[model samples]
Target: MARRALLTDRERELIEGGGDTDDELRYQAVSRVRRKIQEELTEDIDILRENHPDLYAELREVVCESN
Candidate 1:
């Protein structure tokens, strides 16, 4: 199954200059939206792992472990 795209209409509008014009304000908005997207992506990855245990196990093996 294809992954669902992130970013809501409001977020897209903000990114496309449909929101604040001030540099600082725009930066804050973009930063907030970016963080939200990252969180959603992490959640989606977790759900995929839950649905496919073998794939998840292989992925864990490939990922380097930290001390």
Candidate 2:
């Protein structure tokens, strides 16, 4: 299933405003959302590692280069 892109309230307003917003603001807002998503994914991975070690091992095998 496709998920909606996460956006801050300010980002939502800027998008709804229809232009005139600064480019730097757009970049910062996008960066904020990207960081939030990364943090959430990392937390979920940690939980999976503790609760489902075998599955986490398989995931690590596919995703980790050094491990």
Compare the candidates by TM-score and give the number of the best one. 1
> Per-residue alpha-carbon lDDT of model 1 for 17-67, expressed as tens digits?
744456665677789878865886577669769898787776567654533
Instruction: Give the range of the ten consecutive residues with the poorest summed lDDT in model 1.
Output: 1-10
Per-candidate TM-scores read 0.45, 0.45
- TM-score of structure candidate 1: 0.45
What local lDDT does model 2 show for residue 55? Answer: 79
> What is the model-wide C-alpha lDDT for candidate 1?
0.67
Model 2 agreement with the true structure over 1-67: per-residue lDDT tens digits: 6445466568776645556888777777777767876997678679989999997897678778665
Question: In model 2, how large is the Cα lDDT of residue 52?
Answer: 100
